[model samples]
Target: MRLTILAPLVAALFIAFTQPAQAERVDSGVPGMLFDHDVPVAMNDGAKLSINIYRPDKPGRYPVLMLMGPYGKDTTMADAPAYRTSWAKLIAKYPDLCKKSSCRYIRFEAPDPERWVPSGYVVIHADVRGAGASPGVLDPFSPRETQDYATLITWAAHQPWSTGKVGLLGTSFQAINQYQVAALRPEGLAAILPWEGAFDQYREIAYYGGILNVAWQFWWEHQVVPNQNGNAGTPLIDSIGGGKDTGLPLSQERLKDNRIDPVGAFARHPFDDAWYHERTPDGRRITVPLLDVANWTDWSTQGYLAAASRQKWLRIQTGDHLTPFYSDQALALQKRFFDHFLKGIDNGWEQEPRVAVQVRHRDGTTWRNEKAWPLPDTNWEPYYLDAASGSMGPTFEAAAPAAKSWPGLGEGLTFTTAPFVNETEFTGPVALRLWVSSSTADMDIFAAVRLIDPEGRDVTFMGNSDPNVPLDLGYLRVSHRAVDPANSTAWQPFHPHVAAEPMTPGQLYPVDVEFMEPTSIVIPKGYRLALTIQGTDFGYGPGAPIVHAKDYDLPDDSHSGLFFAAHPNRDPALYGGTDTIVTGGKHASYLLLPHVPPRS
Candidate 1:
């Protein structure tokens, strides 16, 4: 922690004097926009990062908006197969896109230079170490990489055309890096708009809920990061500009030496160990203003609930992971935030609601502004479960205890509530409290929350990894359910996931599994909410589309595989046993929810 605090001060001074006052400038002759390609920026550690600058063609200072990630800096939105699928359609949706020019220089997640340059802002994009033309090892999300990002922010602040103020923006890869960099408290980093990214690399990405899912490891290491390796003829670099002409490239040996084995590293350290803690953000140290945006569709929203900052605003949007970043409503709100902070504009941002949520329903969505997350008006209620009847309701009999047992690999039990008499909304995080037992020493709990329409059809929404996923999902290795009391809240239980405390065979243990992803749904008169508790990952029935839309080529497969299959905690030799759900009397099992009343 002290390292993050101390490095920023030293780096700040170095940035002030390193860059030339009026060194090199390129005039695009396109009126308001100028392009500076393959600009080499030096880092404190003697590494030169390949950066591209986009700003007003005229000679004047402007606030800088920057992004740094492994995705090659030369990777254009038009060249990537995943992005080309919807780039044209997405651009058409936002008429404000490239309002001044053709927006030809837009990257996958970076802001459109065409729109920002004319607005008196500079947009800088960089390829971090071991990626693209940048030399060094690709240690994604490590402290070294974070320091490199901090240095880049300071370097931008001292540029000839800079206002000495910087802000970070981008989605997914770009957004996820902001948390770690901000934790360092970079000198010129005035604000951050982390539009839907995970703050905790281990729990959120490497091993979700203490279960190992190598799909991401395989996808990222094999395709995404390698695509941007510091090789001479990388496809992205070649497409943007001749690879050899862009920047200096490293030899094959250097690229391999710099890269870390993410898959092997994850499998080696199954628990929340020092490696993970080092890479994760120290949220308590963050002091900059934050406009964190997440979506119900992307269940990957732990950061929204975990981020700690004095000037922070949370917005929950609807749609897939990429949709929120491209939405017109989201873009305007982001511009307003950056305007107020980086540009020092009197945009009335301080008066805006601290939390803005877009609640979803079967037919459409509704926007609501509140003073805080888990609105002060939230009515915390519990729906008790009856194992004997496989039903859930407001109350359950306590005298007669009932227990239901299911195979560790089976579908398990589902409890649904009675039809609602009036429109009621279930908003915010949810958790399940139950007394569970495993025939073996361990059991994996996979729970999902879904809505059942009057016609008895299941309601699905877009998920960060899968298109048609349940409203919310939770996972817990019964033995690893130890909560970090300091970080845990009633609505969102924080499982340290530091180690596994194997269960006593056939012995019931009380535990709470909290679904970090928030759900906002209105239950109409005839609708019901269902809680499905299963042992394996949930899957859509036969004939159902694997995903609802053409999604970005993220490596994580959230659709049909058991997250525990590759994990030691779920070893068949020790895990394939019957799990029992005990309910009633002393062992009261129930689902806790946030019930929000309609606005007056």
Candidate 2:
């Protein structure tokens, strides 16, 4: 603390002596920057919203850039007593952005006005309703909030300073809402840079492969939601309803009413009933050019990558979730995109490739460039699941055989591979063909594909969320394997995922499961890959962060715990029995990989 106090003063002296006193003057209302006024924008509802507008004084008229978030609009560092003391430290590195255009309307998570205003742009930040000064229910990420998004874009489009071309930029929830609003097709909504956002609430937030994600959801409600309203120590000093969401304090009844039981919502609709159907972003409805960003380490949905890959203009990047927001390269890309789309500037952004992915490198740094998503000429190869030695490989020639292993705790099966010494790239989606037997009516197969090193080590790569994640895994319940043949083909495997059908004690049936898409990873010169087959659900670590819901928690059960019944909910000790044993020999099994040819 003591050193920091003297450090800035000493640095000032060093700067004055080492170089010219004025290195880069910024206009943030500081010696290096400037400020602007807080303008009020009216929403469709009676509630009013406040905006902190940032612009350069020397500009006649400039293209406007806008951001809408639940954070406060007036809560810039200019008013925070503690923030002022620490402002210089942050401003030191970002002098121009922190000081831009008199700094009147500065907010976090935005490029400094001094950086963009001089480039002929006006930045506007809006505090979402139920936050800052806007009024109404604080049900965040709701259709209501999304409706207001379209309204704001249209409102911003007509502003005197705006060119009727407004683009959106933000990360996390900020970016997710852009996808939702864009689906609405607002009149003036031009483009968007949606980064690290998942569109499906079911897969992204509520559940993963039918497992409840209570961890992040619980924390979000506790810490993030409260401040979203006019809570203490929040950014954006303005309140909803022009201070109503903040005025005379919100009623506890109203606050309580806004609380959402996310788990309960999902529990009610085990299928695509009403709740989930309403929450999912209508991707088919979205028709805007997007600079979509994604990270493998993002626990959020990678569906956007799949969604944008289908679009004409998209950039699917891979890095730590937060890297692109602050990285020079990402910012430069965003600047150029918005400059071309919103400002009508011919910045050559249109000629940029349709997809820009960071081909992951072994080291932390990534190789980035333009290419077709799923790389056009992918090799769709299939490897089978042999129920012996618990392996995954291709079936050569199938000979008559006895019944395979049971569902749970039974013999795991087998297959083989002519080990490849050359490196091969596997990109795109994966599929599985399984012939199984069961003693009961239903069965669940936990199928995971892994790369086994020549040294017999399980190869784990950075997944969409975890660095130690496996290559690819797919789940299937025997009865639920009924595919929508109309939608089911080779590349896309559509499952009904509806009811559970019991299996004949010794009947043999074929089950097909498709693994979600993953980028290519070189299998190195000498490596043998393997797949894990199990009946039990997959959960790791102290908390086991994932919880799968089953008929065991149905209305008749009403509660969750160890099961002890039969008929409907069978007793595990008796009929709940399963044969998870795997047996492999000859041409019984194999794994299919969509292999991409090595870069020339």
Candidate 3:
């Protein structure tokens, strides 16, 4: 935790000049855009949070697009090495990314001020308390942080340069908080666009089907801690303030005392209890106009469906997460959405289709607009798994009872469908119903829906972080198989991870595993669809190894880097052993897919 220290006199000098609540105006580097640096907005608790504003130089009144998060407002995309490398690769791939705008003044995962300011919008980036220039405890997504956001939304709306209408926009962390504060129905909050942001903290992120995802621990340690407000060693320099220090430096012990350990909190509360509920958004209360964007390769799907807004739309696109957000086409779509909602323009946006899906095929992608998600004409088909021949078909083969056994830490089994007789499309939610027995007290199940080409090669796509990701993935721990009947649907089963019911060794138990997100892929006449059942995380070759020695052991290079769901912390005595999948006259193990017919 040691950081680069400044001389005592120099440190004191920097604090005296930088910690004040004065606003400094400067050239925004982008033509026609003005920068207001270190603008402080008072929170309800009397603490002033720092915000940097970017707007048209001669703005009368314009709609506001605000992005608030722990990622420092002064931190440009190039400030973080990881982001810088990714941005370079993205630019190399998509040459037209920055054609319309200069791409300058773009913060990580936030909107580019250069792009939006010239579009008659005021762009504001606020630092969450305890991060960047804001001062307070650095507890992210807590009730206090949510309240600060709501207050800021209202404050921005009433500003002299604002049209009294504010719309929320950004990706990931920036998009996540929009759901929380929007639930409060703050005044002048016109609309929100949450792109690839997880809604349910417990199910979607912390615990994936009751299996702990260790990525959050890595995220906090590697990405978050270094950017705390008082860290002099923060790589980010104030680009707007002529390369000044982002914040005053604080002692290591003081920094540690100022922030709560999120990973520890997650370990303590494994269930979907009040602590998680407090952080998750109550979508029923969100009545603002909403445009929820999802990536075909990411795991954020529930926000649009959960929102109660009458004027809501879902746009599911393809490609890696951050790249798509800054693409030319995505920018146009975002501008159209904001123009209709925030600017009160009659742009016929309301008349457009409610759902837009990019149907992917081996050749390319086809954009299709639908009236609703899961398509009204979705044919929910079940392909029964036959363990005897490792095959899957529509009808269950009424043969003698059979079972397939695989070690808990090994590559389990794959059931392949006979090649498609006709070009077929499967483009929505997927589920798996299985009857299983574990040699140990409990077992972890990892299921992947994949595509096999006519040449017998595995078809993979670029995931949010992983370069090779399957069509869809699902996970379930036998101990946490208790389903909530009220929330469970035919295609999606909702598991209430409140209590863990240990499985009796050698006894069969039926469980429905729900894929975290929907997928869209079109199979050619000869292409085949496959279902892989495994114990550990799904990977390219032999898959992730089960290491019981260390609790926080990360996956090797062979596994999906950030998206791997390996539960190393679980007791080996209880989870290690052989797992059996039985399919016969009564067991009826099957894979459920959404078969969408082509539009006329």
Instruction: Compare the candidates by TM-score and give the number of the best one.
Output: 3
Regarding lDDT, does 1 or 2 come out ahead? Answer: 1
- lDDT per model vs. reference: 0.74, 0.54, 0.80
lDDT, candidate 1, 1-600, per-residue tens: 323543445733354334553324555556777777667777766777777787887778899999987766666666665566446655655666656456566667667666677778999888887777676777777777888888888888877788999999998778888988888787788999898877777777677677776666655654455454555645454444444322456677766676887766788888878787777777777778998888665434566555677788988876656545766666688789999999989989999888988887766788889988778989888888899888887777452699999888876899988888999898888888888998899888888887787777776665654556677777777888788989887777788888889899989998888565678888778978888887877766665432222233333343532132454446775657899999888898888889998888
On TM-score, who's better, 2 or 3?
3
Candidate 1: minimum summed lDDT over ten consecutive residues — where? 545-554
Error of 3 at 89 (Å): 2.2
Clashing pairs in 3: none
TM-score, cand. 2: 0.73
- Cα displacement (Å) at residue 200, model 3: 0.7
Candidate 2 lDDT over 222-251, as tens digits, reads 434544553543432442122323433555
430, model 1: CA deviation in Å?
0.7
Model 2 misplacement above 4 A: 1-40, 71-115, 203-205, 230-248, 297-311, 364-371, 395-419, 435-447, 462-467, 476-479, 496-509, 535-590
TM-score of each: 0.90, 0.73, 0.92
Candidate 3 lDDT (Cα, whole model)? 0.80
